[model samples]
Target: MNLASISTKQYVEQRDKGYWIAGTRISLDSVVYSFLNGESPEGIVQNFPLLSLEQVYGVITFYLANQELVDAYLKEDEAEFRRLQEACREKNPLLYQKLKAAQAQKNSAA
Candidate 1:
């Protein structure tokens, strides 16, 4: 067996400004979050039909092998998301308020 092939096989790549499943645009964060939330590999595959069972398992293995680095990256990504959300809310207070009210109504109905 080519140790190089086994050692160099990468499940994720950083490009287009984010980490994605090597050749697909599906973000690693999506799989990680779903897995963290108790979703099975099959469930994750269903949620992201573009991904295969192998790809999901590969990404999960990658995450497990690099949990500390991946966790820090996740934290940074979440902070950026919150910052962008706040900026959007400030830019469109009316739309934000309308969405918030709609969400509340939906929740009450549920």
Candidate 2:
């Protein structure tokens, strides 16, 4: 199937609406987020081996099919990611700071 277009039916779920990302261990939000961030479908599949090519295509299709839904999912996921990042920072002060600083420096240079 073409990876460029997908549908909601392809956006499978498990446990609950938000329990699994597109019917795989990967969450719907995370997959969409990575794809928006320029991750290739194959890259996403590799990162999430639990996902079949169809699942990846499905999520990609879902996002393409439902812009509003995908956007909302991405927003919620951003907050969740920030929460985790902050928690990690608190848990590992030095490492967190080092990585943050490095990332910031890299961005600034760019």
Query: Which candidate number maximizes lDDT?
Result: 1
* Residue ranges of candidate 1 with Cα displaced over 4 Å: 1-8
Give the whole-model CA lDDT for all candidates, comma-separated.
Answer: 0.94, 0.76
TM-score of each: 0.89, 0.55
Residue 57 lDDT, candidate 1, scale 0-100: 97
Q: Tens digits of per-residue lDDT for model 1 on 39-103?
A: 99999999999999999999999999999999999999999999999999999999999999999
Assess the local accuracy of residue 13 in candidate 1 as a C-alpha lDDT between 0 and 100.
93
Q: Candidate 1, after superposition: displacement of residue 5 in Å?
A: 7.1
Clashes of 1: 0
lDDT of 1: 0.94
Query: For model 1, which pairs clash?
Result: none
Give stretches of model 2 more than 4 Å off.
1-10, 14-19, 77-110
